[model samples]
Target: MHQNTRQRLINNFPRSSAQHLPNTSNANGSSNLRRVGYIEYDMSRMLGESVKTFVYVGYVVEKSLESIVDKKKVAVKKIVCGSAEDCQKNLQEVKILLNCDEHENIVKYYKTETDQDFNVYIAMELCLGTLQQWMEGNIPTIQPENVNPVQLLKQTTKGVAYLHGKRDAIIHRDLKPDNILLKLVGGKVCVKIADFGISRVLPHERTSLTIKTYSGTRGWKSPEILNAHSSPPGNLRAHPRMTRATDIFSLGCVFYYVLSGGRHPFDQNGNSPNPELRDPNILRDRKNTKIEHFSPRIGGYIRLLEQMIDKAPQQRPSAAEILSSPLFWGHDKELNFLVHISNLMQENKSPVIQWCKNQIEEDHSNNEDEFLPGLELNNVGWMNRTCEALDFYFMYESPRTYDEFLTKDLIRAIRNMGTHYETLSPSVKASVGSLPGKFMAFWNNRFPFLVQTVWNVCKVLITDPDFDSVLMFYQTG
Candidate 1:
C-alpha cells in the first residue's frame, strides 16, 4: 500500500490499536486468538477475484468476557501490500466502507487489523455466496419459491442508491454479478453489494470527475472507459475517462447476464446468426450492435436496461432516478411471476400447464365459477398481465398449439367457462374472446381448440342485445 493511502486508512480509526495475539489452534485448526471485542479464527484458503487482496472465510467472536458471546461468520480480506497500486486499491475499499453507514443491501464492514508487516486485514460480514455462483448453481426460473432475479436487482439498485446518496458519492467501477453477494434474509435470499476494490469516491458537489485511470473487468467495462484511450504507435494505451454512469452500464450487463441465464447480451450464442459476436471478448462488439435478441422472458425489463446502459452517459438514469422508475413500482412482481411461469410452460408445456391447472384447482373453492379468477380480466392491470402472458406463449411456442401444452382438464375448464358467456361481464367476454384471434394472427394459424371454445362462447354471448361491441371484437379481433 502507498504510504499516504495507508495513513488515510489509519486515520479513519485513530483510537484503535493493534495487539499481537498468539496463533493458538485446536486439532481442527480453529484459532483461539481473542481480542477485547473480537475472537480471531484460522481462515480457509484464499478465494474470490484474482486481485492483490486475498479473501478468506472465518468467524469473529464478540463480547466474550461480557457473558454475551456471539460468534459471527465473516469474510476477511488480507492485503499484504506489495506495491503502491495494491495500497491504493485496498485503501479505496476501506475508505468507502468507512464513509457509508451500515445498510442491509451493502456488505457490513467490521474493523481493520494490521499485523507487524503492516498488512491490513479487513473483516466483513460473511454471506452465503456470490451472486455469480448462486446464479450458476440455481439458474433463472419462475418457480413459486425460487430466488427472483427482479428482486435481486432491486436490492442491488438500493445499495447503489445508498452509495450515490452519500456525502462523497462512491462509484463502484465494477458492478458485475460476481461482486454481489447474497444472504438469507427472512427465508429469502437478499443481494448485498461488495468488493469495492476499484471503487472511487467523488466530491458530493461535483457532478463529474476526470479519472484517467482505467479499471474494471474486460467484458463488463463501460464503453467510455474503453474508448478513452489515445493510441500511440508501439506504446501502451492511455487511461480512460469515467463517470458514475459507468457502473450503470456494467449493471445492465449484469441484468442481461441474469435475464439470459449467463449469456452476454451483446455476444452471439444459440440465437445469433452473426458468428463474429461469438468471440470470448465481446466488449468491443457490445457498443456496435443493438440488443435486439434477448430472452423473451426479459422483454418487460429490456427497456429499463436499455436506458441503464445507454451509450451516452447523460441519457442513463442516476441511481436515485432508477429507484423512482415505474418499472420498480408497478406490476413487476406479477409480470415477472407470469413471465417465469410462461418460460417453464414454453420449455416443457404439458407438465407446466398441468401444474398450473392443479394449482388453480388447489387454490380455489368448488364454486364452479372463475376457476382462474384473474382470467376474467376485469382488472386492467390483470388484463395487461394476461395479455402479455398469452402473447409470450403464442410468440415463442408457435407451430406448437395449446393442444399440446394444455391438458384435458384445462381444456374442459375453458369449455365450462365458455358455457356462461351470456352471463359474463361485457369486459370479460371481450377479453377472453380477443385472445384466440390474437394468438392466431400472431402465429398465422388459427388454433382449433381455442377457436372452437371462443366460438361456442360467442354463439351464446351474441344472443344478448348488449353484446354488440363484444361480438364485433370476438369475430374481428
Candidate 2:
C-alpha cells in the first residue's frame, strides 16, 4: 500500500480498537488492520482498487457472551476524495445505488460512513467475483454449468431497463464486463450490475445531455461518445448526445463479450502475434468495424445486437423494447404472440392485418423471388385462409405467403401444442418452454423479414385508439 493510503487507514481506525483484532500479513504483502464500527473490514483482504477507491472484504461483527462473532460478509468501498468536487462525484454513486437498490439485478447498497478526512466508506453486498474475472478463468469455484450467459444478459438488461425507466432517466455512461458482478442466489448464478460513479441522471422533461468531457471505456464505447470530444463546435448537435441509448450500445458489446467467451467484437485482432501494433490496430479496427464475429447459434440475438449498436443513437431500441425481444421471451410467450397474430390475421378488417398485407405486397413486388418464391397466385388469396385451414405450413419446406405461416403453420402448432400441453410430462414441458433459440431460428430461417415487419406494423398500431385494448393484450398477456 502507498504511504498515504496506509496513513489514512491508521488514522480512520484508532490504536485502541486496532489491538482487539489479529494482526497479520499475507503473501501478497497486504497487512491487516482492525477497525471499530458496526461493520468491520479486513484491510489485508483487498478485493479491488481503482484510481479513487479501494474495496476490502468486510463482515458485520457483533459481540456475544462467549466471543466476537462475524455475522454477515460484505464489501467495503473506501473512496478517497481530495477535493469537494471529487467528494460530490463519489457521493453521486451512493445516491444512485440507494435509489435503485430495490432491483434484484442491481448491486444492493447497505450503509455509508465518512471519516474526518472526507473519505467515504460504502458497505454493499459482496459478490463472488466480477464477470470479467469469471470470464478470464480466475474464479475456479464457479463452473460452466453454474453460469447461463443468456440469463446473465437478461438480468443485466432488466437492471438497465429499471434504471432507464426511473422518473429521471439514468444513463450508465460506463458499462463494461468489469463492472458486472456475479453472485450465487439460491444455488444459481445471478448477475448484478454495479459501478455508477460516472452515471448521469437526466432531469424531468430532458431526454439527453451534452457533456464537455468524454466518458466510457474504448472499444466498449458507442460511436457517438467516441466522437463527442472530437467533433467541431458547430457540429456538436450533429453528433449524438448522451442518453439511455448510450448504455444500450455498451450493453450490446458486453453481450457480445459474454457470448463469445471473452473476445471483444471491436477488438478481435487486438492481441495478435505482433505485440507492438496491437493498440493502434485495435483503434483502427474500432473506427471502421462491422460486427460479424458472433456465432450463428446465437440466432436472433445477432439481429438484436445489430440494432443496439447502430451508429445512429435514435435508431437503437429502448431498454424496455429490448426486454420484449424474442431473445428474452419464454416459449409460452412466443407461442402466445404467434397465436395472437394468427387471430389478427383472421380479421381482414383489422388495421394490423391490412398493414401486414400491404407490407407483404410491397416486399413481394420489390424482391419477387427473394420474398416469396414459387408461389402460384391463382391458387387462393391470403384473406381466404382462416382458422378453418388445418393444413400445416411447417410440413412444407417454406410458406408461399405470410398469411399461410400466420394462419396455417402458427395456428396448427398452437392447437397441437395447446391441446397436449396439460398431458405432457414435466420434463417435456421444460423442453417445450426453452424454445427461444429454436423460435428465433425458425423465424430467422423461414421468414427472414417477418420479425422486423411485424414490429414495424405494431409500432403503427400502438398509436391508434381503436387498437389500444388489442395492443394491451399483446403487451401484458
Q: Each model's C-alpha lDDT?
A: 0.55, 0.63
Q: Estimated TM-score per prediction?
A: 0.61, 0.70
For TM-score, the strongest prediction is 2
Instruction: List runs of model 1 lying over 4 Å from the truth.
Output: 1-20, 23-41, 45-49, 63-70, 83-89, 138-145, 229-240, 270-297, 329-477
State each model's C-alpha RMSD to the native.
15.1, 8.4
lDDT of 1 at 221: 74
Structural RMSD, model 1 = 15.1
- Candidate 2: list runs displaced more than 4 Å: 1-31, 34-39, 60-71, 231-240, 268-297, 347-351, 358-459, 464-477
lDDT of 1 at 458: 32
lDDT of 2 by residue, 325-413 (tens): 66655545555555555556555477566876566445422333422332212234332322122233223422233444332333434
Error of 2 at 386 (Å): 24
Q: What lDDT score is found at residue 119 in candidate 2?
A: 68
Error of 1 at 453 (Å): 32
